[model samples]
Target: MNILEVNNLNKYFRQPTEFHVLKDLNFNVEKGKLTSITGKSGSGKSTLLYLLSTMDTDFDGSINISENEIKGKDNNWLANFRNEHIGFIFQFHFLLPEFSVFDNVMLPALKLGKLSKEEIENNAFELLCLLDVADQGKKKASLLSGGEQQRVAIARALINQPTLIIGDEPTGNLDSQNTAIVLDLFKELCKEKGQTILTVTHDEDFADRSDRIIHLKDGRIVT
Candidate 1:
């Protein structure tokens, strides 16, 4: 089944002129699949991601995530929906520098308030363990090495058990060993937990290894 569906998507930037960034895009992301979006610079890969993640409402299209249309929702509605249904990881870990690794992972679930505090704590620790960073949970997020920090970030993203995980060059900053760790983690999420992932990446090997790659050029899918 499709966890995400996009149809007739179009995005434009206005200022100098009405320049279109994404044009008539259409796609579906299958549940339990790891999909990558690949493109050259200015090909609207990131722009398309922003729209799919419901961060940019200025675009024209129908985007249905988890079977609900997100086109007309307000920021407040979108924010709440996103917190519950979508998880995000960026090139930078984006963990709070001063927060402990455990706290950083628990923040989203704490805000969600769907689970008991004890349950959230258990899940947070479990995720950290799953990500192989349980030992670092007590330290400040900034104190860990880059790979450790990224693992913590992934743990944070999974704490909420989002319907879909979206990543923007999640391994962009990592060394080869760390990159392999993350790539393996993504595969594990899909095969073991039946999670769906959609990531935008410049890493050719990463794209090639994914279940599928959506290649874009001139704001349109060329492959």
Candidate 2:
């Protein structure tokens, strides 16, 4: 089953003329597979991720997630859809420096108002434990090491149990040892939960671990 499908996708930004970030891109991610999108800098990899996740809507063509079309959809509905179905992990971790790691992870569940307090806490704790960072839950996210911080970010992303996990350079800041640890964790989680992951990374080692790799070149798939 295809968890995500993008067809003839085109995204352009207006500069002096027009900056074409993605041009007629087509791709699909099957369920329970780890897919990597690799490209050089400024090749629209992150732009593609943002577009698929509904973070940027200024584009053309279709992006279908689980049979639901993204283009031409209502903005409000798309926002809600992303909140309920997509989990994002960015390079920066994007954690609230002031909030405890537990609270950071619980924020999305609380905002969606879908999970009970007990359930939300349980899920958050479980994720942290799975990542081996449970003891840091009460501490501010800023206090954790780069690897630990990203681990917490991963846990926060999974709190909603999103079907599609989109990661953008998630291990970019980590050292070799930390990178290996995080990469192993990602692979283990996908198999353990049967989840789909689509990640954009320049790390060849990380890309090698994915089930499928879609290479991008100047906004198009290179095959």
Candidate 3:
């Protein structure tokens, strides 16, 4: 089944005299698959992702995720929807330096408040272990190495068991070995555990290894 559907999507930036960032895009992302979006620096990959994540509401189009249409939603509604249904992993490990790795992982679930604190803690730890970062759970986020920190970020993203995980150059900061590890983890998550993922990356190897790749050029999908 399709987990996400986008139709007639368009985005514009007026700050520099009205430049279109995404142009009439249409696509569907199936459940339990890892899809990658690839493009050059100005090809609107990141802009499209933000729209897909519902964090940029200034677009004109229909974005349906898990059967819910996100167009026209207020910021408050969008924020709640995002927390519950979508997880995000960015190039930078955006963890709170003062918080422990475990706490960073549990933060989102705590904000979500759908499960008990104990259950959330358990889930957080389990995710860390799954990502091979369980031993670093008690350490402050700043203490972990770059690769370890990224793994922790991945664990945090999975803590809520989101319907979809959105990644923006998730492995950009990792070494080659760590990049391979993350790609394999994504494959396992999709093929074995049935997770849906969409990522935007410049890493050729990463894009090539994904279940599917969508090429964008000059704000439009290309064949």
Q: Please report, as a residue range, the 10-residue window in candidate 1 with the lowest summed lDDT.
A: 52-61
Give a tens-digit lDDT track for model 3, residues 1-223: 9999999999999996998889999999999999999999999998999889998888888999999999888989999999999999999989999999999999999999999999998998889888999999999999999989998988888888999999999999899999999999999999988999999999999999998999999999995
lDDT score, candidate 3: 0.93
The pairs that clash in candidate 2 are none
For every candidate, C-alpha RMSD to the true structure in Å = 0.7, 1.2, 1.0
* Per-model TM against the reference: 0.98, 0.96, 0.97
Best-to-worst lDDT order: 1, 3, 2
lDDT of 2 at 143: 93
Please identify model 3 stretches exceeding 4 Å from their true place.
Answer: none
Top-lDDT structure, candidate number: 1
TM-score of 3: 0.97
> Model 3: which ten-residue window has the lowest total lDDT?
151-160
lDDT tens readout by residue for model 1, 1-223: 9999999999999979999999999999999999999999999999999988999888888999999999889999999999999999999999999999999999999999999999999999899889989999899998999999999999888989999999999999999899999999999999999999999999999999999899999999988
Give the clashing pairs for model 1: none
Q: What lDDT score belongs to each candidate, Candidate 1 first?
A: 0.94, 0.90, 0.93
Q: Candidate 2: which stretches are off by over 4 Å?
A: none
Between candidates 1 and 2, which one is better according to TM-score?
1
